[model samples]
Target: MAAHMKEQTVKVKTRPDYSKQLITDIRWLLWAVTIGGLLLAAYCIHNGYVGSLPWLSAMVGLPWTAHGVVCSFYLNMAKSDHKEGGITFESAKANSFVADETNTEGPMG
Candidate 1:
């Protein structure tokens, strides 16, 4: 009776998406930089390094922290709202890329 039954097989993709992995790694890097910068700033203040050179740590760390914050903001803004279905293209972006009559500057008048 078992011989009369047929067997079925399923195939799966062998290749992995490296781009997705790279994106995830980059996100982790942003978090690391933010935390590292804050720690470095704290260390500099605690050890009185600011007495000799006040702006060194701030110059180095603040930009990195700001960069991480910017990245996080964009990331959050980009997340799709599954519950709400999705965002409309017009509402998602404040400005449209489509050309309008106002932009008249050209290579030749």
Candidate 2:
């Protein structure tokens, strides 16, 4: 006779979702960099040093790049929200004024 062996199932714990927190942190860091870059750009422009063109361009570009990244993040969030059945302003408005089928009174009556 063969002995029967019992198998045990172990449940694995999942890590909490940190994607939103990570995105928020990244946005904050980018905004900080954008502010710092704009300030540096202003300083570079005011000083008008001959060889500072590269530095000025880099400083100016940094803020624009940061802005673009933040905007892209927002766009991605909106797209994901729409895909996930999240309600939007337009959807809310359309859903708000659903005609009541049971109503028999006319507007003139």
Candidate 3:
């Protein structure tokens, strides 16, 4: 027997202006630790504190490269979808109160 599938449209979430929220979600602690690790690695190597410890400097490289790749993917997606007439945050917020259905009151006596 053969099976059939029906096509459905998906509402993809897109943010018109994402910079502010992105800035708010940054992990400062992670950055500090990564940079501190690299600096410590340099210090140890400079002081001739040799061992495999210097390799810690590369600890941050992979994650940063991965982050760049992921960000690039999102940017490309946004560029490709730039022609879409998506609603902006401010407009969505303003329109949210119009049909909230919070007060489904019965007919007044």
Question: Which candidate leads the pack in lDDT?
Answer: 2
lDDT per prediction? Answer: 0.54, 0.60, 0.56
Model 2: per-residue lDDT, tens digit, 4-107?
86665555544323644455566687667768777877777678845546765576577668667866876776676555356544564566746544443342
> Which runs in model 3 stand beyond 4 Å of their true positions?
1-20, 23-30, 84-109
* Candidate numbers sorted by TM-score from highest down: 3, 2, 1
Task: Flag clash pairs in model 2.
Answer: none
Report the candidate with higher TM-score, 2 versus 3. 3
Comparing 2 and 3 on lDDT, the stronger one = 2
**RMSD to the native, candidate 1?**
15.5
Model 3: per-residue lDDT, tens digit, 1-109?
Answer: 3368666656554443454245324345448768888788889889998578635746766556655665677666555544434333344456762643433433210
lDDT of 3: 0.56
- Identify the leading candidate in terms of TM-score: 3
lDDT of 1 at 78: 45
The candidates, ranked best first by lDDT, are 2, 3, 1
Off by over 4 Å in 2: 1-16, 55-109
